[model samples]
Target chain A: MKKLFFLIGMTFFFSSCEKEGVLTKGSNPIPTINNTAVLKYSGTFVPTSGITVQGNVNIYAQGNKYQLQIENITITDGPDLKVYLSKSDTPSSFVNLGNFKGNGTSVYDIPAQVDVSEYPYVLIHCQQYNHLFAIAELISKQSN
Target chain B: MKNKLKKALLFSTLFILGYTANAQGCSDAGFCSVGNTFKDAQSEIKNSIEIGGVYGVGEEDVTVFSPYAIYTRIFTNRFAMSAKLTATTANGSFGTISNLGDVFVTGNYKFNTGDYDKSKWSGILGVKIPLTASNDKINNFSLPMPYQSSLGTFDVITGLDLAIKKWEFSTAVQIPLNQNKNSYLSQLAPTDKFDSTNLLERKSDVLFRATYKIKTENQKFIFRPNVLFIYHLGKDSFENVFGQRQTIQNSEGLTINGNLITSYRLSEKNYIEASIATPFVVREVRPDGLTRAFTIGLSYKRNF
Candidate 1:
């Protein structure tokens, strides 16, 4: 019984234990994530819809140095609003604000920073969801 | 008042930037596989829907639109089989070649020599069953080719795929292996002079293809543009329309083609691919460039 116990211990030591965290094990011992959600929006391009909320925006940018800036504030006819962060967003530790547009206009098309280092948290709730449509992301500018 | 304004602007800026930088988060309904097997299968399915054909343009202009679908099932790290179905329309203004269609099923086996950071080699085998009929239009009448066109003339295809890091290399060949058809000769003759046995000898062909790929998203997405060179081997076992001894070298020469493909994974079960092939000469077997043609097509897929 002692010999069998020792052999069993060795068996478990060498198997597929090395690739534990990376590759999935068992019949389907896959990794699980808790805070992921689906997002979908459609617009016909009505001048950034006035609000201009964007996610998955692919633009060209550098570190958190604030290399580029866009001000889309067309203060048209909308209510006064405020922006806040939610903690559930993963992948990014924290989010940063670039700047506001249309200091005093009929509509508001706020411009945000293109750097990913600072704007990590991607959750933004708005009392105004219809006006904001697209999110701009800074892509690499090396190639055309 | 100063602090309130700064904070308000700060929050607004973060909110906008954060939303714009949103990646295809894991929470979406679709799934994109990260492993090698999944990536390969993803490329194949996406490839099936591409809309470009080599033999589409006639000697002077594009005659028809060519479309095809490919399906592949991966069984192991190095083994899989694929089925391709295709259809090509007729270019009437040019010559006589009419609508063409085919259905092919083949198996593939790959060998992995590289490890977590190495290269691998893959081989593929498949048979073509020409499901589409072969017809040549004469005025209002449809004149069928003497031999059955599609599956009846089973064509076997084979190829090898090699990959080192993000760069991949592959080559494939196809050979027809079915009985020869001789009805066309019979049509030319009244009866006694028609020899059914002496119809088609040069049906066998060999196609060579190569590809260059740019892998991204840690190899999850790949952009591989490829080129194909095809040569119809041997010679027509039969004779020319004039019943004279003539070498149809022009019709039986080699062909060249190319395509650029973009493939992405939405989720494990869902993936999308797109591609375009430039104008290529089809039916080099024709005596004149007037008979040359090209093809293009695309497909969509969901893993069950």
Candidate 2:
């Protein structure tokens, strides 16, 4: 009986130690942009203290609809990271673009209700830990 | 016996009237079914085994099926113990996942009421043990609580039940001892309609149930209709990306459900039961993902 109990205990222990799922780094290609797509604003990513980030962010307007694009970007991989269009560098008042795909040239559609002009800064943040990884202050192409 | 039956009927009518007049709502995370709280009323057998399963549609139209087994041993007329194990399978847009759920070990003590036929009271204490860490994931993304088999917290459960003839009334509470290590972030699964469950901290819950039983002339068949109320003690909390705890608003509220169970005795020691339950009221937010639109179950019991 003791041996049988020990065997059952060991089996349970090993089963409980099964591997958990882990996220891996990947890349996505930038969306196609035609001549009709005009640049509205652009900025370069600036890393937070002790972090590494290199990227250029651009907002384009095709008619009234808008899209945000990140090009040639390299960022520190983190858990639950997201891209945000924020009123300030902090994520207090912001619209979540979605999860930040690693080292990506990726595109995100801006909601029609969101006034991009009011959201002057773009951020890469860890939503779970509330850590800011990178910030980019948009400069309007028309203003420049 | 005639007087006892009349008193039970009167009490049952009064209780139903009061319940309907001042009723709220709530949900269950497993404590309500522990021990002998809802088992076949006091049997003369010293030992028994039960096997059962439930099928239900949960949050976001996820189909959930759970199969369980329970073993009970009566040490004396006053004391008994039960152990239950359950396994769950959930299928939804995210995918299919199945695993061993939680184990509940409960001890029940029937109080000495000199007149056992008039009224009997029992107290129950139990502990829920999780079989898996609540971090099951699909495609490297953590699945929400609805998809995971276990809530992944050690919980203490305690309750009291009073039975008078054909009516039974019970109240119970379940308290979590620790937070689960689930790291589900809604942002990662933008298309899914689930809330963030990262390191979810569930609040305590209290529940009350009133059941009335009816039996056939031969006593071969029994039917019970129950009204259940559960209240989440407070808002649940979850750890954010910044490693700070944030309250999940609207997580605490009441849910009310109506349940009907029918049982048939195949022999002196063998029985079968079928049950159906539906929620009449639900909380605004249920981040812990225990919501069920409806549940239907069947079980077999054998007494020795």
Candidate 3:
């Protein structure tokens, strides 16, 4: 009986160990730009203090709706990364676009309720750890 | 013998606590086991205490361990009351979380049938109260419902059970009193493939179960095979980031499960039971996070 109990205990101990998920590079191809689409804001990605990042970010006005696009991007891989449109360089008071599709061109649909003028910074952030990887300060292409 | 029983009870409790396992996919929302649903009908005990543990794997390979205790008091031959407390711990790629799950208080009233040996009928009423807020978070990001310990709603449960010789049939309904404050949006973690449970308003669930019992010649062992069906009355809804209520498509449907229970009498006042359940059919979307691939449990019951 003791040996049986020991075996059961060992089986549970081994089975209870959590399996870690492997993070793989993901891709989201850029969408085709229509004639109705107009460039509203553009920015270039800048790495945070110790992070490496390079990309061009653009916000396009398609009729009343808006779309944010990241092109030719490369960044340090991390867990639970998210794309956010923030009012400031920091992630506080932000509209989450979605999870970051690693190292590629991706387009995210901005909610109609979100006003681009109010959120001037596009941020790449690790949502799980609350760490900022890169920031892009949006410059108004219409104003230029 | 008394000392041996005490030691056995202590050992079982310790084993359950240390197992770190998971629980059922009945999708009951707290009504299926309300009042004498799975109790032994022939036992003459007026009161009893039960300790049990269940283990299962849910969506996204999330492992869940649920340990529960139940206390019952029979006021008369016709009336009885029971209270159950459950605690849950979930571990997965997201993280590990532990919390008190829910509490259920239920009453059962057996009605006199013309012939007691031929048939018996009982009415059940119960209430479920959430112990956790159902909004547990990790690093400010809200964990999905799979990680939540409770469904986070006050619910009213009503049911009826009828027993005829070796066959029993029961039907029950659970209605949530209010929406939960959970703010987990799966879109924020798209790779996880979890559904949004943000400010979720769940629909009511109706359950029906049929069981057949078989007893050994010596009456020392009993076996029960049960079939359970649950249907969501309507589509559940959740709040979007834009503060709009959106219905989770295909969230309203039916789930059918097959369960087998075996019980052994250790003595006049002691019994041990083991059960296993697997789904035969499942809904397309289980945003509530009660989707279990399978479940197995063991319990010890002491009667007085």
TM-score, each model?
0.45, 0.66, 0.67
Writing each residue's lDDT as its tens digit, candidate 2 over B164-265 gives 888889899999998886877675453448888888999998888898889999989999898888898999998654445789999998888888889999
For every candidate, how close is chain A to the native chain A in TM-score?
0.26, 0.78, 0.78
Sorted into a CAPRI-style docking class, model 3 comes out as incorrect
Model 2 spans with C-alpha error above 4 angstroms: A1-144, B1-29, B35-44, B113-117
The order of the candidates by DockQ, greatest first, is 2, 3, 1
| Model 3 chain B: lowest-lDDT 10 consecutive positions | B15-24
- Comparing 2 and 3 on TM-score, the stronger one: 3
Give the per-residue Cα lDDT of candidate 3 at B217: 98
Give the range of the ten consecutive residues with the poorest summed lDDT in model 2 chain B.
B20-29
* lDDT agreement of model 3 with the native: 0.77
List the DockQ of the predictions in order.
0.00, 0.08, 0.06
C-alpha displacement of A82 in model 1, angstroms? 84
Over the stretch B253-298, how does candidate 1's per-residue lDDT look in tens digits? 5655555667776666555666545424444343211222222333
Q: Could you tell me how far off, in angstroms, the CA of residue B185 lies in candidate 2 after the best superposition?
A: 1.5
